[model samples]
Target chain A: MFGDLTVDDNLRLGAWQLSGRGRSRRKQRDTSWVYELLPDLVRVRARKAGGLSGGQQQMVAVGRALMSRPEVLVIDELSLGLAPLIVADLAEHLTELNREQGTAVVLIEQNARLALDLCSRAYVLEAGRIAAEGDSAELAASPDIARAYLGEAQGLPSPPDAQDDPGPDDPGPDDPGPDDPGPDDPGPDDRGSADSGSHDRATADPAPTPGTAKTARGNQDTTVQSARAATREAK
Target chain B: MSDFLVYLITGLGTGCGIALIGSGLVLIHRVTRVVNFAQGTFAVVGALTAISLLDTGLPHGLAELLGVAVAAVVGLLFGVIAIGRRGTSPQAALVVTLGLGILAYAVEVMLWGDQGRSSEGLSGAVTVFGARIQTHYLLIIGVTMAVFAAMAALFGRTDAGKALSACSSNPYAARVVGISVTRMGLIAFAIGGALGGLAGVLLAPMNSVAFDSDVALIINGFAAAVVGSMHHIGRTLAGALFLGVAEAMVAGYGSATYQTVVALGLVLALMIGQAARTHSVVAEAG
Candidate 1:
């Protein structure tokens, strides 16, 4: 809808039908308020919206939505096709708006890192099913979550056991143990057991990466064998 | 040279009428995404209603106003049926508009019969540099100018216009912002219908307007809009003027039967030219 309309007019249209106050007062309050939030828009108020950059247009889109004083604002793909810096700036505004206005904001984003960072609670939808849902921090710390998103859990230190199990019926006993190999080892008396213990730990965890050694063949598989040998030799 | 001036001045009258209708077409299409083949039905209906009212001894201006109002209401109804619901596909809506136009034509024929209708326009002719011009032609030109000025002001300076433009630009976003896109489409239809009605009144006296005559006006108007890519208002007006002048010249120097052919040919040539220009720009970018 970016025609030859001036940016000011485009913004005004966002709240055009909203009536209760005097026309001039409403115009002054709503438009100037938008300008206050998006200061960059103020400089280009007289310019046509059609000539604006994609980022600017997106800002206008958000500004326009805000003018309506919506109870719940839903934004789709807040980061899609946008620069990282721009997305960050927009996220800042969204946070500010949510805090100040008590506006419920629902953001749909493909960038998991940004989404998990910005939201207090998040849901991960896979094939229309919610695969995961919880406090953002809790979800981020889960070993399975880490394995799925942040790479192998063995590389990172296991956090405190606060992540909610996916369900009551499926309590994953060995899932967290692999990440805490020091605590999970049966005993220190048998030095040879450490190598077999690591092997057992890798097998117990279903994650493909650390378990790849048992399944693969060729030069890469030999390297893995040598790495295990080296670990055993060091022990 | 004087003969050329006469033809040009005469051409402007027809050009103004076509431009007004073209503007309505563009506005409706922009808002509703429907070509609205029934758009010219407004003109025919308005003219016939006004003519009928005039025969009953009503004031000419009042009759014209009422006619335009009738057309606007009719347009609003059309919009509701064609575009009100969310689930109706745009293609389906376009077909509905076409069906409505056909229905209007049949209804007009049944009501007013096949006889062409005419009105008594302002009779005085003004001579300028040896070219005698009808006062009605001047009125048409003046009225069209006024309408364009009003439209520009509405679109450029007003909140309502901006809302309308917003609906046209991004209906989903407009709805998200609480603008009723369906209502905007209805408003577009209303304004578009009024313009079409006004065009019919301006052109009715010059030609005996009948039920089927709207097709020619719609064709010329649609052709004019195509010259401007169906979006630019100023360009559409200029395109209409150019088409009118060229058609008049062909009528003056060649056979009257070639007028429709010339209009269609001009549209094709302009389309080809625009397509080539677009291709070249794309080629450069590539």
Candidate 2:
């Protein structure tokens, strides 16, 4: 295969010659469709492949594999060296493929957040062994599972449904403080509504703040530790 | 006027060989993403092989064919060795190609004993427009034209051509479609090597063959490739012709030592062009 060939020609080479399926016509159509999805590739189709950016090269590699119409698609590292936005877009597309085509994709990724978000079920492999396995939600909520795959220092948040339930507020028969209103004072419906609203706020408010605070604190701690270490070395 | 025409013809002849080598370098870079420093060595090896066979009383045509075949094998070996290792850094691969070039030069020195050998003229001179020109020049023009035409047809009219094109544009997509990148790389190297060999054979009669000639030829070829952006063969050929003419004119008008300086200036110009374009792209992206 010549490197100087047009994009369509290159696609056809992998299509007809590599697969030996004799789908030259279909391959051309497929290439056009691919161009529709990745329009930037169209302008550069006539351009040499070596002149393309790293992301574009990754797209070409993925497109070439798609031409074979395989049941199982295995991408070595989906997020490797790509910008975050492009990786997110690619992950979204892969999810669509999974939903529409039922294609089983084996995506090996070093980014745990991406993997957990994209896959319905996952196995966390550490040192080539399955350290943990469960549904995304279950594993996310499991503290033990999080500690194993993700470091304890990772400070991963619990899943949305894993929040603590509010206990019933019972007023004792003997006495009540002025600030503490009796349960019957507000009526059952008002009391119930207020209780639910407060519960929602209590659960949602601290969740995000703690995560951010943890990150900020971690950064500060690292900076302090490094400074201390430098001072010690100087001494 | 006649003298100018004679120099033009000579430049064109040299340009043909440079274009072939430049195009080969571009092709290898397209597929493997490495600037092969060994390309000149491959050319020299091809020339030496042909010379050895010719010295043994073999026909020139047969000797040339064997030389091309050997060069193809060498190219295949290079592709396998340099590109086969998964995750080989581009810098490491370039260093390896340079090493291979040195190795090839050493082998040539061992075989031919570092002596300058002149080849017999390729079918004598031909008269064109009242000026004497070598038939070899016409051969070079004809061969280069034919090869470019064939490449255009292959790339524009064939399936394998499209696959290669796609591979270059987006390797990941190509792989997802099941293109064997390694196989494509091998094919790219073989074709590149064959072209380099052809250039060597075409150039053998024009200059004295020596082990060290590889470095200059490879440098010139790389410069040509860069000047053309390693894309269009026609542009690469045009660039080579331009360089050849400029070099000849400089040699005629000034000291020969200035030719290297001129060539260096051309390289600097091309690099500046590349950097400016890259800077603009960054700005646009921002």
Candidate 3:
């Protein structure tokens, strides 16, 4: 029933006890009906069912079950290992069958996104038990819903707030002070800074306001001092 | 030139027998994928049975008819036993048919002994284009032609034939469509056996009838079928004709002892043809 038989043969094998006349009629009707749903199968109608692709074989298997005119169709892992596009196509047909034929379809799938999209209502199973139940949209948006149904991990803390941090006005040790020595100002340990400090005062006092000059001088001396410290560290 | 014509006529006669046997082989192979090695044995058994019955005071036609009927029944039995038991393993079925061939031949040897027996030809003769062809040869040709025509009609124009073809193509699908593959297999075997019996009846008068005579006929028939690729009936007939003509040419131009060598060479050529086709299939797959 599962292997080597053609699609039509598989169907006939399932319904063998029917009267010969009735069997042929049923077979023809089923063939046309199945072809209508999955037109690609029409080409391989005479081909062995075992030789078809995974998706086509699945359709044949489903078609065999349908030939019995079963009230309920139970398909396990409808999207298992199938390409997304093929899964979507199969899902559309299943939905059509469900709506028009009133054939109840139980589709089990691992792709939560696809399952949620196709199914009207779904049960999220965890460890073999129902963990949650709801409509698709509600399930898609819930935080806990997102975590469980969408397979996202729960219980991770959020990052700290950006608005409450200290303002940029406060300075650290790197900032220049008003009393900071000029380049030519004599230092406790005299270097070239003592010579450069008088020259700066001479050029600065007449050129700009004294306070602005003093701040400018202090900034320059601090920069030079930092450079000296960096060079010493390198050496 | 007269000698050449004689060789050609002889080749044609032998080719007719080979054609009949090859067609039957193809029929069975198409449906069940097994080349029934016992096909020739069935033929011999049927012919010997007819001869034995004639010796017992039965009318010749009645004995022949009874022989054909018995052969058909034997085919049905072989179908039931060999095909039913082995299913889809063509190789296993081939081996089983080989064993059955041995069994049938041994039984014939036990009943008739190893001596050669001559039987009467069908009847009458006619001059065809200045060649005095025997009435039996005409009968063989006419009967084989009719069989081929009937087979073409059966397979081409009948519902039963289509169903059988479906079963052969895909047993599962055939089963699903409500065809009983087992029943179809039986039909194939019966047809093949009946054809084999017909070939034996045609050839029995021309050659010495013995227990081991069927082996050569079966081998030649199988070789012809293989040479034709076993798919086309026309090709199969052509292969039989080719083999027959080659054998006759060898017998005429070379020593009679070289006949076996010619046959062996023909078989080797067929095998090489099959091997070459198989290599192409592998290359395509790769």
Best by DockQ: 1
Q: How well is each residue in B211-252 modelled by candidate 3, as lDDT tens digits?
A: 888878888888888876765677888888788777878988
Which pairs of residues collide in candidate 1? A1-B169
* Candidate 1 lDDT over residue span B1-286, tens digit each: 7678777877888999899889988998877778888888989988888888888999878988888888888888788888888656668999999999998888999988889999877789988888887888888889899989999998877777877887676554455445666788889988888888988887888998899988999999999988878777788899998888888888877877998798779889999999999999889867
Off by over 4 Å in 1: A1-6, A21-29, A47-51, A99-104, A110-112, A119-148, A151-235, B279-286
Q: Least accurate stretch of 10 residues (summed lDDT) in model 2 chain B? A: B169-178
Structural similarity to truth (TM-score) of each candidate? 0.76, 0.62, 0.64
TM-score of 1: 0.76
Evaluation by DockQ, superior candidate among 1 and 2: 1
What are the runs in model 2 whose C-alpha is more than 4 Å off?
A1-18, A21-67, A71-235, B253-257
Q: Candidate 2, TM-score vs. the true structure?
A: 0.62
* Residue-by-residue lDDT tens digits, candidate 3, A1-235: 2343466665444333344475675563355676677676788888766566655665665665555454555555555444445556677777777777766655554445555556666666654556667765566556775553343433222211211111132232222211123322332321111111110011001221111000111233432332343233223
Tell me the tens digit of each residue's lDDT in model 1 across A129-169: 56777777777677665555434544223322222111122
In the range B69-151, model 2's lDDT, one tens digit per residue, is 88888888887788878667657888888888888777788888798775665778877677788888888888888988888
Candidate with maximal lDDT: 1
Instruction: Judging by lDDT, tell me the better candidate of 1 and 3.
Output: 1
Error of 2 at B151 (Å): 2.5
Candidates sorted by lDDT, descending order? 1, 3, 2
Question: Candidate 1: lDDT of B22?
Answer: 91
